[model samples]
Target chain A: MSRVSSKMALAVKCSDTFNADACMHCGVCTAVCPMGIEMLPRKLFRYVQIGLEDKVKENISTIYSCLLCGMCAENCPAEVNIADNVRFLRKYINENEFNLS
Target chain B: MPLPTKDILGILADNLNQRKSVLPISSAAATRWAKGLDLPKGGKTVLYTGHLYQLIPIIDAMSGQMAKFEDSALTKYFGLGRNVNKFINMTFFMGMMASKDEQKDYDRMLRNIALLLKKADVDFGYLYGEELYSGALVYDEGVDGSFAKHAQRVADMFKKNGVEKIITVDPHTTHTLRTVFPEFVKGFDIEVKSYLEVLAESGIEPTNQITDDLSLHDSCVYARHENVVEQPRALLAKTGAKVNEPRLCGKNTHCCGGPLESLFPSESHRIAGNRVEQLKEAGGSIATMCPICLVSLRKAAKGSVKVNDLSDTLAKAYGV
Candidate 1:
């Protein structure tokens, strides 16, 4: 599962606004979620960073279910834009899976 | 089973693209709250509701209906509903499900906000029916293309109305208009302030002594996104009320899960229930600054905690 796909690598490229690479596997985001969703800004971003597209796919609902309330971003030690990363993933899904503009 | 995210978001995106509101509502129903308020139309500064308070009851009714359909076979029809919605507005049926009393309660909050502004002698006008929804839902949901077009429309409407400054009633509207709009709409330069911020600046002294103990639920959008944490607290303090802080509050505030209401109703309710427990421990009537927070927390509170719009508390204190 650690085998990286150049395709997946391309998909998760760091942008000026979105940098999951800045995450340091901190569990603060998971602890702070109002829903107590565990695969949030921490595990999800870790998945993205490792090019685990299948893992990201399995948790698509978890991504959409986020309140985007900024709690995770506030508590993050690495100062990652956790909410924006979730949104970037959503946009990726919308464009790829749903074919939405 | 996974949720049909594509279908649900498709319906919302279609509605926004076609109807200009996430839910299709008549302009009369949208602007009915401002009736008899005699607000001057089109001014340099305006009270921009963003139709957030006005649309809450419909959102509640629509989401309540959708919640019933969540795990059922009827979920298949969401795609069909989206197709039909392109021509015929299915949300009208949903809008009819909204409780009149709930509508009145939310509308009363907006009225109280306006009255408080009046009491402060703040010079402002209203856009009335011309006001648009801030596209906060689509933006948050990452329906960027639809949101961008809708944002441009809202910005153009503001420019047409000569609105240099706007006093937004809720945090979602404030954050969207103030922060997100600039990115989507070129030259979007509207000065956006939440009513609480405006009131805090106005410094209207409380007339009636408020002795009620209040637990304040800070909106995540206000607290973290827009830096509006202190403004609401400051306004509440002016009422001579003792405001209790929940364990998770201020910049570290917990979400009410209102944002998930559209797609994940059951999970949304579960999260709201959890936040209500923490808020209830604060020991008093609960106050919320956002309509989404008011509705989400009130449903979880179930009359046991007495959730209220913060404006209502301020209305009583300032004798508005």
Candidate 2:
């Protein structure tokens, strides 16, 4: 089981704290993602919400792969801040999972 | 295990004689920027070299120290600092990993800016060893405690050095010092100006002839965040660089995939690839104002197109 650290919690919290509920769960962010990354935004937040730490761990590539381009956030029909959520996930991953040493 | 940032900054402080987080690539150039040039005699401008610019030189010198990292677990994770016998190869690999070219660019960029500012008659003094990293990256990385601590240290240094007005070279530094510092450090009231803004005010004329159709990429921080959209275009126009517009130009401009490069490299490359396509489609070589953008786009272009710092474009036209 993946540890339930504050990094994971804060990463999840960013979605709600940043008002990600405004997200309509549309596939536009995934469509606009230049890299064609599959995990996308809403799927990631949902993993965090459900405390699916292992699920997040499984998609570590997608988590670190986020470009934080803000294009998705800019085009969000519901005006959710997808970029900030990805950033929060990056912080969590860097601190908890990766070699940002 | 990740290497502690304290160790990173500590080694930097030891090698550089201060804790500033400037890259090691420009260490020599940074020293030379102020060498034999009398400060306090200038037009009261303290040029602040932000993080990622000004190579430390010590990092290369400390390559020998990496020998300890050979068998270390940290090396396995970060994927280097092993193979000490081939120090030469390892060093080059480290340079590539660290984006040494970008460091060199800032050093060169500084010299060109110094030449231009001299032409503008704006006397400027670099703080040299006294200036510290504004901790901009630390904050951006969400290391809140370190950022707060480092920000205080930076503020203290400014006060200790009696710095009043500063000319910053990058938008991130300019944004942090001008906007973010006030929020973090109470009574942190100091005037911060980007060199571009200062140059814009100077109205200096360009001497080099430019005939290339250049497409300028405005940085998100520089344009949308700071409203510095016109100054660079005005400077490029003054230099006679024929400008072309990309599909996403001005405030509506698209990302260059830089901000996430460190955390998400391959994905950032994809974004850079897309941005390059947009710029190439604009029918001109790219001119970038931000250092990160220059590095990212240059990598993505793979010599297929030229991507250069706006300073180089200006340097060709106005360099002394």
Candidate 3:
């Protein structure tokens, strides 16, 4: 629940190369989540594209809870690697914390 | 390709000497390894499939659980500790190793355990089979066989026993029971939860101080499939110990290289070493939830860092 620092902001912005745009806003990822927690991956994708760091971190647990099963990639029309994006989000969060300190 | 049995034993020997604890090798395999060793009359022996036999003792020893079972195979070999009725064995191991004809032999061993427990007026049940719905989604296609077969068996057993809920130690089993089994075994009304989740729910507090820094090695079974990332962390946090985060942890977490260890030692070692380095950089003792991860990571460690199972860590902290 901590604030996202500038470093994390940079990472989130830089992760555009991983094709955050490919997400179709469907909720298959959330439906398959065994924890039954809502990740809103599509929303996170939109926020990241627009440099909305606070929105991303506010839903950080959703990102962290992802199983990284590559199921989303398999299902995606663009074949986007959504799991890797989630990992980058986590890395961004951690790197931001380190930088803030 | 066969496993490097001598090399594995040599490592085990070094660890036992360093920890100053007797390492119990499983009787069945050990006898095969030590072909000429004379069996002592009335000595108790434990039989495990090759994989589980190698894994369980090492992790248990590293976590200090092996010491509690003093009369175990390890103690018999080292000539230490009094024998107790309690023994640890895995059903998965038996299932993997037992030849079609030898399955009866395996069942007999399990039946013996049940008899021992019954004589003591203690009910015993082996927690084997699926727990979650998503587990069936993945496992139904794997080599393990159709989920329907195990689902029906579990349902019938639960109903016959008049059991309302089941707590599983392994997250994989917990998930399968909770989610997937409901798909095949309709009206299979039984609650499924992980042992750690249950303990956390009980509001148990750590009785002893754990001042050492700790890093969590999320089990692939738990983290990847079940999303049980925070429960263990919360438990560690309750102990007031500093929790370190690894570079690639939680969902993106790498396997402790368990499946690959015996088949591909060098690759497994590289992966384990990579994880160990992450833990070391985070500056804390690594704690893992899965037995497989504990064993694989410990073997992979090469003495560079300390690895402890979460239960063992909690036990030490609580002075249990």
Clashing pairs in 1: none
Better of 1 and 3 by TM-score: 1
lDDT of 1 by residue, A1-101 (tens): 45655666686774454587767775888887877877787877877777877788888899899899999899889888888888888887787778775
Candidates' DockQ values?
A: 0.85, 0.29, 0.02
| Predicted structure with the largest TM-score when compared to the true one | 1
Per-residue lDDT of candidate 1, residues B1-320 (tens digit):
33478987888888899889887688887778877888888789899988889888989888777788888887777778778878988889877889999988888888999999999998899987788888998888888899999999999999998889999999999999999999889989889998899999988888998898988999999999999988877777767799999999999999998998888888888989999999989879899999999999999888888999998899999998
Candidate 1, residue B121: the lDDT equals: 94
- Per-residue lDDT for B205 in model 3? 67
In model 2, residue pairs whose N, Cα or C atoms come closer than 3 Å (at least 3 residues apart or on different chains), thus clashing, are A101-B3, B23-B55, B23-B56, B24-B55, B24-B56, B25-B55, B26-B55, B27-B55, B208-B317
Global lDDT of each model? 0.86, 0.65, 0.50
lDDT per residue for candidate 3 within B63-175, as digits (tens), equals 34322333344433322211110132222243244343333322332333223222323222432221111222223112122335545655765665556656455554555
Q: Which of the two, 2 or 3, has more TM-score?
A: 2
Better of 1 and 2 by TM-score: 1
- The candidate maximizing lDDT is 1
Candidate 2 lDDT, tens digit per residue, B44-154?
Answer: 467787644453233323333443443457644332322231232333334445434545555677777666777788877766755666776655654444565667888
Model 3 residue B211 CA deviation in Å: 1.2
